[model samples]
Each structure stands twice: as structure tokens, then as C-alpha cells.
Target: MSTLTERIDIQVKSRHELDEQLEAAVRELQEAALHVRARGILITRRLPGRYTAELSDHVPFGMTRELLR
Candidate 1:
């Protein structure tokens, strides 16, 4: 049978491991946030005409191009 001290030690070790894992998860989240922020910045800077050009390439069979403009 495990003594009280041993049980306490085991619990402490488990808690420490959990804390480390939590820290790692937090770091990953922070990195992902930075990536998302960078992508948002890029999206905000897109040329306004780019959307029309992309849409023009995929116009439906019968849709008049003038309608879009």
C-alpha cells in the first residue's frame, strides 16, 4: 500500500505536469493569434479591384459582364 507521503508526491507531480501542459497550450494559442492577426492585416490591405477581377473569371454562362459593373 502506498503511504500518505507517497500519494501526496504523486499528486504533486501530476499537478506539475498539468501546469506544464497548460503553459504549452497557452503558448500555442498566442502563436496562432499572431498568425491570425497577420492574415487579417494582409486581407485588409487587398486591392479593391482584385475582387472584381476574380469574380469576372467565374461569371456564370449567361450573366452579362456589364451587370456586375
Candidate 2:
């Protein structure tokens, strides 16, 4: 029970940090007033401690894609 509580706390903290970072990105882009969803980042683990991130057209604009995950 204690372990689960600790894990939840850690996840909560991490999520908050990620939210802040995303907010900063949106603010820096200067598109705060407008909502645009067309592209996304797909990160995949390549090697140990290394990963590859690519700009994917997964964000539904007028089409859809199969979610494998």
C-alpha cells in the first residue's frame, strides 16, 4: 500500500512538470488563443537510454489513424 502511494505521488509530480513544459511550449509558439491539432510527436525507444522522436500526422484533422498502443 505504501509503495503504491509513493508511485502515485511520483507520477503526479511528473505529470505536473510535463504540463508546465507543454504550457511553456504553447506560450512560446504564440498560439495560445488558437487551438491547432494536426501534428504530434511520436517518441520511440531506439537504444538503451536513447530514443527517436518524429513529427507524425496522428492528430486528427479530418482523418483518423489506427492506434497500436
- Could you give the C-alpha RMSD of every candidate to the true structure, in order shown? 24.6, 14.2
lDDT of 2 by residue, 1-59 (tens): 21111001111135566456434543432231123455444434343333333334553
lDDT of each: 0.27, 0.34
Tens digit of per-residue lDDT, candidate 1, span 1-69 = 522110011112355664564345334434443433321101111232221111122333222222222
Error of 2 at 52 (Å): 1.1
Q: Candidate 1: TM-score?
A: 0.33
TM-score of 2: 0.30
What's the true lDDT of residue 64 in model 2? 22
Residue 50 lDDT (model 2): 35
* Residue pairs with backbone atoms closer than 3 Å in model 2 (clashes): none
Residue 37 in candidate 1, Cα distance off native in Å: 3.3
Please tell me which predicted candidate would have the highest lDDT against the true structure. 2
How far does residue 48 in candidate 1 sit from its true spot (Å)?
51
Q: Which portions of model 2 miss their true places by more than 4 Å?
A: 1-37, 59-69
Q: What's the lDDT of the predicted structure labeled candidate 2?
A: 0.34
